[model samples]
Target chain A: MRKGFRTVSGLTAALAVTAGVGVTTAFAATTTTSVDFQTHGFPTVAAQAAIPAGQGATIKAGDATVTIPTGTFSDPVEFELLEGPLSSFAANAPSGQTPVFDFAFKVVDQKTGAIVMKFQKPVMFSLTNTDVNANSMYYNIAPTGTYTLNPVKATISGDTLQHAIAGAPVGWVVTSPATSVAQTTSPITGLPFADWLFVGAALMIGGGVLIAVRRKVS
Target chain B: MRFAGRSRKQLLRSLLLVGGGALMIAGALEIGRIPLAYLRVARAEQTTVSKPLVKVQIVAPPPAKVVSYSVNALYPPAAAPGHQPVTGSLMGRLEIPKLGISAPVTQGTALSILAVSVGHLSSSVLPGEVGTTVLAAHDVTYFHHIDELAPGDTLTVRTSQGVFTYKVVSHQVISVGTNVPNTPYPSLVLETCYPLDALQLVNQRYVVRAVLVASHLTPSSAANQ
Candidate 1:
């Protein structure tokens, strides 16, 4: 009787240890890094966030927020401000001419400050005179990398000729990851529920073995 | 007597055996049902076709008289010049006589836009502008015959500002992760997924490089027509 009890106890202890190890491993797999855009302007946020390759990062600028979804980064990256022209509007330019903002920005490593990406292009912003009070401003940002800026709300306010632009933050210009199709494995051939089956089988088998041993003892 | 005189241990053993047998049978049944559950989920996901997030209508070309000028005369004064109104419409027409392709170039490369016409990647330089102007289209449809293009092929873009002509310089196949090449002079880059004959999606991109060779003044009245 004592021998049978000891055997059952040993099996229970083994199963408990296996479950504890599984839980610990799962917890270790996920790592998250958060970035506050309000505290650090885009240049600083881009410089600080340690987004992993194939993963994503989230940015919050005051009331406006955007998510840099997974697969946005082909590799790990940090952003740094390179010497370039700031976005500005011309007051006395030709009436038909759209204002151009040519600038250079770089993506670099957060710790090493090594440059990973650079862009020097003339990005244009158009102003449509909607009545005398409010003008609708429009611009298009096409990403060159594997990153995308989710819909963001920004404000355009400045003097009649030159305005201080806010909410028009530009960073992480890249293509959004394509939606992935979930593939179905042949259930009969590849049982995803095999773990559950194993657990149930283990429970039943352990119970049966205990019973059989008990019978012999009695 | 065997039933009435059964020991407590014997009764406990019988209960354990019965309970274990029942659990094993339930597990087997559950294993059989898993595939069915997975099929239902897969079918649901497959049937759900979401619309493209951004949809911009193709804008009509402006009325302008085509006055062909030499490429040398059309170079912008600056590598990155100030923004000039190129077109009033969101779409421009790209004409490649060599490939017999004349497709509307929309503002964005959304799947919906690519379905019927090519897409002008946003932030890319406009036609006649100095900088790299990147355009993308579906390989199967609009750019199906892109591989037939050769160096020196003439390409024209009719935008709001005017018409611009380009001569193909070279072509190459690049991995998707690689950055698109840029030039200090006026250039055009056409991109599409490669292996034009591939039955499935491929990670390689076929890029065609072209330089501005001519500029044509579009008559204001012609754009209206």
Candidate 2:
């Protein structure tokens, strides 16, 4: 479902309005969209600006900046940029990827009332790095129904993650792709020794109870 | 001392108590074996031996579109073309020659799967791939002796994809959430609950990292024969 980008306070009302618009109307519009950032426990900072077809616009959210080049979109669009903490997606992260920063970008067609997934030309997106790994790589959460980290070729120039993208509606994550494994959960819940102790206790108690019952019957 | 003077109930009760006590002691001994084994072989000593870097030859599989949040949804289908594996499906067998461990490795790290066999973390690259392939098991079972695996020891993995040999590079016992350091080479990481003999849940994990030293792909191995 597509909803016009709004501030954190108005996010709920906007989503409610979109839900009321029904499926047919929503599909008739562009289907390209990102999950509501606030809904997913992401930081509540979003910026939106309308860029007419054949024109370019620059939008900034927090320390991140996005530049849409002229003729990048064949249609007039409203650019949306949202920023949040990378740790929010820790559980969903691809193994071995330690994410330090996160961003979500979406493009909505102004006239068609739909989100834009592809671009006529590429756009430049950059973020002023904060505690980002120097050896980190750019990855986008592929909407393949799972949280797949697709490496995006990017360069770091003195505390910045700058990269070019062919489309919007991407969940951009910067992660250090080192480490063969990160064991987050404890693996041993059932120990053989513990099981044995329980078994022995049960046997001893059962035997003692039977001996007492026999003496009473006699 | 006289069995003729003892009643049937008394005899039965004595047998049960003695039998249960013996069984409990046996269980304690089983748990004691883990620490004893560790003492015989020292905790992984950091060796400074410089081994030649082995070239990674196996081409990593193309990025599969499988991404899942649930434990059951994590695994890719077992050697099936264009299919995702079901959780607990057999992926391969892991062998540690030094420790005499040969255990089946399953796909996902579900408790049910780890209780019986080594479980592969779903998000890692498969064995012999360019990235790290992570496998884990319960310390009570396949990984009880992992602490005895010192640097320079060799371990082999046989999979449908190929046969791979990795040399142990380092071992560390870290807090549960700390990440295993990234390596520039193709690596394999084995993890189990720490303190191997802990009778209850622990907050640390024992990790063993190894680099790929040799590999024999299925096609090449078959052709050589």
Best by lDDT: 2
The Cα RMSD of model 1 versus the native structure comes to 28.5
Model 1 DockQ class: incorrect
lDDT of model 2, residue A113 = 69
Report residue A53 deviation for candidate 2 (angstroms).
55
TM-score of each: 0.34, 0.43
List fnat per candidate, in order.
Answer: 0.08, 0.21
lDDT of 2 by residue, A44-133 (tens): 446778888899988875456888889988788777676553435544666666655566765678777666655666677776644345
